[model samples]
Target: MAYNPSPKSKAILDQAWDWIQSVEYQVTVRWVFYRLLQDGIYSEKKGYRHLLSLTSKARKGFYADWRPWTLADDTRAPVLVQRQGFYGLHLRGHGFQDEDDWLARIKEEINCPLDRWASQPIYSEIWFEAAAMQGQFLHYANENMPLLAFRGDISIPEKWRSAERLAERYQDLGAPIHIYYFGDYDPKGLLIPASAWRDILAWTIVILNSKGLTKLEALESLNFHR
Candidate 1:
């Protein structure tokens, strides 16, 4: 009596599961549909309609709970007259250092001013076009993996500022930053992958230069949806 994902549905589910496990977050229904189109599982014309049907069927007291999940909000749309499901992701950092030790010892050393950034290892980051994707696509693949990040469809002033500050803090460490982005294929969507990286780099230079950290450059990589 339970719903089993057909081969077609399973293909999309596989991607979602991978993303959810890697990024330690859940995927929104919108994200699922968009990703399906991106992966060529469904044509634009068919993907939207197909996903809508699948999700609708899932909401109608389907046997399989994971077929379509919805967070509980009595006032929210897609009104759930009955039933609920459980999903979880585990993505805690593996750092052994405790907060006390960080403040009492390593904080100053790590935060100290530096002169160059060439010696540091390459850092990689990932961004998704949609903000909701942040949960399942923002973190690193593992604790040892390079840094990963994300932003909403548009820029956020605080997020940018925070990035700038981090860049300044590590200016002398010589780490090169790389970024990977996931998004739609629209005119604006295509530009964001590159633009977001540039904005931070430019801001980093300005802010670090203000602090007298001159003659420093961070190698960076930016790739986005086509």
Candidate 2:
């Protein structure tokens, strides 16, 4: 059955919808609730719950002209596709005249690639404790370096995945991996990088054992900095 919001609820939904549309980056429902709270629209826990309920209803097509894509939860998104824009159009003032022209240009661009970090001594990545701040970091981060948001203490699976990537890259490129972590100065923040590094090293050791590298040797190339 379709949900029908009350007149008051509809007004709130309208505001939330407008706010969501105004932002360029995708936002989680929790983030949206907090943002609304900061605007003095919501005060207590009950209000937060109400916003969640209304967001669910709006995304489910309970309201007219509201689509599911309007509110995206990146954490639960099954498949993510990168939207690659053509900046060349801005410079040339005319995009490809036809489909064939576009394809030809794409093929040429793919074949002739510019290696930005080829001469760099080390591979670097920036990690954030708050996932929502990723968009801010992405705005300034270099295209070559990855920006990861741990959301808190990094998970075991994520640590293992990072370890695998680091190990593989270290072995292939013979270069070091430097991680620059950003977080608060609280107790958890102070210890999270160390804890995450330890786990990653443990996983790396296991993975690199087959290559006849010891724990100390593997640790040499994986540098973690705050």
Candidate 3:
């Protein structure tokens, strides 16, 4: 059934809709509600009932179709850059249209690599893990760390590429890989670490076995710390 928002609810929805149209990226319901409150749409309405009503209406196409804002299956997103004016990008090995010049640019300009493989070599035994804490893991909040660190979710398959790389590096270094982990003590929190370690173990085993290395037990020196 469609949500029939009241006139006041529609007014709130319209205001949020206007803000959504003005931005290029997706905006959350709470974000819209704050803007509406800031604009004095509702005088000091602390509750979320009206906001919920508007969102319900939106989801049902009563206000606006919510698919664009909510239908993302992959966690990866495009990297964005902000600047005051236009920025030009081309693969000439040169900055502009020059017939003879190839791949040469001013010294001050930052060069963009043509290769897709961007990860560099590492020589560290230390690794960090955040059990389902995406904010700390994938630099979701831009928490910077070395290449050996990573974040894991309920299913570790998504992080398998990283796990495989880490295992390869550890094997080459002939050192035990130590994972320093951060996880909540709650129900879901406690389980993520164990599950993550299981996948990591599986990934490492596959990499080692493929390499035809001996001392499988000695080579796979992986451990997780709280």
Tens-digit lDDT track for model 2 on 51-77? 876876665433775644556553653
Per-residue lDDT tens digits of candidate 1, residues 1-226?
Answer: 1456777776665564554355445445556667667777777755676765565434322424442233121122352343323212223432327778646654455454443334546554455667566566435354433333344333234335545655644654445555566787888877775666555565555556666666344323212222
Worst 10 residues of 1 by lDDT: 67-76
Deviation in Å, model 2, residue 190 alpha carbon: 1.8
Weakest lDDT window of 10 consecutive positions for candidate 3: 67-76
Residue pairs with clashing backbones, model 1: 117-174, 118-174
* Model 3 global lDDT (CA atoms, 0 to 1): 0.55
Q: Please identify model 1 stretches exceeding 4 Å from their true place.
A: 1-120, 138-140, 144-151, 213-226
Give the alpha carbon lDDT tens digit for every residue of 1-226 in model 3: 3456778777777777788677877666666777777898756666456675566446434245452133221344444432333345543343445733433444356567442222424233334445245434456422334434344443233345546766676665655656666656778766776766665666566667777755456344666676
lDDT minimum window of 10 residues, candidate 2: 86-95
Error at 122, model 3, angstroms:
11
Candidate 1 positional error at 22, Å: 46
State candidate 1's TM-score.
Answer: 0.36
